[model samples]
Target chain A: MRVSLRQAFAYKLDFIFTLILGLLVSLVMIFVWYAVYANSGVSSIGGLSLNAMYVYFFMVNALSFITYNAAVAQTMQEDVQTGAVSTAMARPIGYNTNLFLNSLSVAIVGGLTVTLPMLLIAIVLSHTAVSPAALGLLLIEVLLSFAITTCIGYVIGTLSIYFVNIWGIINLTGFVYYFLGGSLAPLSLFPKWLANILMLLPSQLMMYTPAATLLGIIPMDEIIREIAVGAVWLAALVLFTLLWLRRISRRVVAVGG
Target chain B: MGLKREIKFFITCQRYNWLSFLAYRMQAFVWLSLNALFILYGILTVTIIYGVSSGISGWSYYQMLFLIGTTGITVNAVWYLCNPNGLVRQLRSGKLDSTFLRPYSRLNIMLSASGNVDNSTTAISSLIMMAYAASKIGVDAAGMLLYAALMAAGISAFVLFVMALSVLAYLLIRGANFVNGVLNFMSSSSKYPLSIFGFAGQLIFTLLLPIGIASYYPAEFVLGRLSLSSAALVFVLALLVGAASYVLFHKFMKGYVGGGG
Candidate 1:
């Protein structure tokens, strides 16, 4: 883990460029939503205030920095497809353990890369207040969300063994999560039934819960409920990953080395 | 004879894709349904906004839908037909070397590299919505024709610009997947009217990204916001941008070192 962390920091240029790209996109989206709020001139959309909306979007952008695990999934998929998985399988450590440690290291680096710069920018440009209590809660929510998202990445990577073309699936899932998870717009903006249905999906745990917590839109009790829900989902996802890996490994017929 | 040969080649490519898609017809149907669902989401968002405000930037709900539908169609058309074949992969894999050796023009080979019969669904749906919106907005045939031409030019310019950017990526990174993702996100914003954004945002889309011409300017022309002269100027600008990018790409190709052995 320490070695991998050091390696992740060694790739500083990729991290910096990716951080800059994330910041630029987040700023652009904020400005877009700001325009909408300015035009509407109201604090509430289906009962969300302007400040609430801004806070929600800010948290969305911030959490987006830490929650990406697609890189790990893609790396694992490449290894599996190119027969590098067998090389790792021959190593002393289990392949899954190695991947988890590597993913954790990279995720830590990515989280800091995004969160640190965003913290500076948010302090300078944003007007919303974050109380110490709220900040602490926000941090907890973000960590849980990060864990859940990483588990999702593992499941996705494992499934890539069966479906060689994971690119389209990743993209499609990402799009659905972005929209239906209420990252782009508030859940209240969606139809009530559709919003309820989306809340049942794991995607809402990624962006919506964190954003809601940060914005103080969710009550403390509700935050506890969401965290519980996220933990349950994570547990299920891990189980699913184990089962999938076992099934696929048994069915795996080596094609070309 | 040349036309016949081209037609035969196109038909052969079409048949190949058709057979492959037919093998997984359910998957294709599901994918098409998802695409439609996304469009419906866009329309629904616009409807909700219009419910509060009479229109966005003086355009009605149906007109906004038309703008979005057309933009979706144009973008998917490029991605489906041109991008899969024209991107850095062929160059990296040395497949482009064979094209260079061929008697046919490089441009022709590149353009025809991928066929997107599936994307016709988007185009067909867009046309239906566009027709409905145009009739409601009292758009004449000439206006529609001008809009169509602008859309074509915009799509061409965008594809060329992106291809040029991909070549630039060769000097830096082997794969331009990140660039492609960024472009896809930026283009997604084109579904809305550009005027909704601030002046700086508008300028970024117009000059930096060129997405304004893709949907906004043409929609503006249809709505009579842009004068004929302005539309003509935009058309000319699109051609210039496209030609310049094509030239840049050819120059870049001269120096491209093929990836891998």
Candidate 2:
């Protein structure tokens, strides 16, 4: 936590810049939906009211800020490439644990410093009224979502130990995660059949499910099902990531001096 | 004679760049996939949104496709022609000192050095996509010609925007990182219709930053929604911005203290 806080402070400029960019993107999305709603002359589309749509995009933007941690991927790749992983392995704490903690710290700091402020503004400007219960549920789901995404990051970082130039892989992973993870547009906006399948993936927990819950668009039964599925996905990713890290750490040969 | 020599120099650089890229076929393939997947993602995002609603702002589905295609083409053209990656590297490694000693203008050397083919895949794919969208919208020959001309202007603006970012890199220690974040925002948000962004957003994008002029306005011109006089004004805006960026870059270069001690 201390290290993460230090790191956050260290890159405070980046955090602010990124926060501004995220807000701009959310603003753009809000205007797009507003224009669409006006043109369509409809109260709502895809079960999202105008306010709900604004709130959903806002939550997704905030959720994205917390979950998408590039530090873990870049640091892991660099450590492996420069053989710093070997030295770090000699320490008592495990490599994955270190990375997970660093990632979690960044999420908490970024979420608090950036997303929280943006979320408040979004809620205020959009006039979104969220019940305590829904807010609590959204918070819990965000935690789970954070864990799942961090696990994926760790997995990608571990892959770098094998492919020295995993830049392409990282870009591919990001594109897929953002596209399929409901950051680009809500999964609800996708074709029904496609959304159904994508809903089963880990990404559902990352942005869609939480954003939906926050907007109060999700039903009680569906929320329960999503939680169950998310828990299962989280467990699987955790196990797979741990095993992968253990196996790779045993075989890692640092290249750079 | 000098212009001919400059063209030859750029051609030689591209020849070597492609050769070296082909030597690592796997790497090239990876880059191609990355670009291709991004384009696919853009197309799909627009499709999904249009599938949900009528169209973004006042633009139709095919028109939205054209907008994204224009953005993709302009961005890739800038990436291929004036990639700042080499400049960032040169600045970081203090190699700009040696790079500046060459007979050619530093700007020319920087632009031509380490030519990028990574975005070529994107350029080609987006052109095909744009053509298909134009055909769907029944764009005429004159419309197509105007689109092409406007696109050239857009690319000029896009390159200037990147050059502005590059010049910023020479001014600050972490300017590259800052520029990257801003560029990501510019590229991503500009993929949508400019109407989606309100007055302030439009002003920033169209004038201060000028990405909208580079992509959205050109698209609007192609669609016949924007007048020729307005399009000409936009081209003039591009030229003015490009000239300003050139001056700023040269001014910053004068003060550049290399990263090395």
Candidate 3:
């Protein structure tokens, strides 16, 4: 964990670039959504006033930044390509454990340096009524969101063992998460039928749930449901990851032997 | 004769790019799938935005599609042929020196070597969307020709601008990247009617970014919302941007000293 933290801290330029990208996305949404409100002459669209919509995008950007750790999958792809996974497996320390720590460190550093400040500025800029309780729950949800996304990273990373190149799949997975997870738009903007279906998907828990909760657009009951659903999703992902890892470990062993 | 040789070289480079992509069938298939999904999702985002509200004032649904399509094609086409990523790599690898050894001009060599085939499919999809939008909006024959001409100018300017950016990136990392960020911001702004961003946004995009000439002005002209004089000015503006970027790129290249590989 310490080593991973140091590694992340050393990447100052990357952090700045990532921060700029995140801010630009939020600013673009600000213009687009603000324009929509001005053009429509509506006090609120999708139950969000202009300020609330701004906060929603800000929170969405922060949450997406904190939770995104596709490096695990990408790193695994490189390792498998270079035949370094077998060497790691021979070490006394476990391979997945190290990767998990690295992922955790990355999430922690990003959240601290970039996401948290943006979240604070967003909250200060907006007049939304964010209660302490809702804010607390939102924090927990963000952590859970990070865990579930990391699980996805591991699953996709394992596919590198079977395929020669998984960068395309990795890129596709990112776009899917961004679109489906409410990073692009709030669930309220979706069609009624489409919103209902999206609500049932795990992707909603990643970005929409916490962002909506803090903005006070969603109810207390829904926040509680989000927590429960997120818990179940994390457990399922972990179990699936373990079983899949067990299956693939033997394939590596056979090839190496 | 030189122009003909450059065209032949460009086509050959494109062919090699296609061959390389076909070699990785799985990668090619997945990338194509990604482009298809981007089109689907891009259309969905526009549709949902309008479904909720009247959308940006004075613009109909098809106009936004046309604008989006034009912007997508300009950016994708420029990026496909002359990518900043490729330039960054070349600079880092000291590969610029090797390109200088080739008989072709520096710009031609750099562009041909860096050309991307994947974005060709993306540009094609945008063309389809633009055609559909034009059919819906009933743009006249003259309007269609003007749109095509402006798009050519826009693509040329954007490609040259990206070349300048790569050089700027090589010289100063964050400063150039800051401009690139602004470019991204402006490009997203271009997807909508620039009027909505007010006079300030319009000036910024037109003068600093050169984005509006590529997509917004052309789309507006086709829709009859913009005058022909305005469209002509935008076409001229696009050309000026291309020339300026070409000068800027060459100016920086003069200072670049690459040891032969």
Name the top TM-score candidate: 3
At residue B199, what lDDT does model 1 achieve?
A: 82
Candidate with better TM-score, 2 vs 3: 3
lDDT of each: 0.68, 0.77, 0.79
| Collision pairs in model 3 | none
The interface root-mean-square deviation of each model, in the order shown, is 4.1, 2.3, 3.0
- Candidate 3 docking class: medium
Error of 2 at A205 (Å): 0.8
Q: Score residue A222 of candidate 2 by CA lDDT.
A: 88
DockQ of 1: 0.20
TM-score ranking, best first: 3, 2, 1
Looking at candidate 2 chain B, the ten consecutive residues that score lowest on lDDT are B170-179
Tens digits of per-residue lDDT for model 1 on B124-174?
Answer: 676677777778888889988999899899888877776777776655565
lDDT of candidate 3 over B1-261, digit per residue (tens): 988988888788888878987776776888877865665555776788899999877778998898888877876787588656556567656777876886777888788877667877778888899899889988899889988898889878877877887777666552334444545566567777788777987897777777787778888888888898988888889989999999999998786777325
| Per-prediction DockQ | 0.20, 0.46, 0.49
Best-to-worst order by DockQ is: 3, 2, 1
Q: Which portions of model 2 show Cα errors greater than 4 Å?
A: A1-15, B8-28, B82-93, B112-117, B169-174, B198-200
Candidate 2 C-alpha lDDT tens digits along A136-175? 8877788887877777888888877767656666677767
The chain A TM-scores for the candidates, taken one by one, are 0.83, 0.91, 0.92
- Scored by lDDT, the top model is 3
Candidate 1's residue-wise lDDT over A39-71, tens digit each?
A: 666666666765566556666776765665666
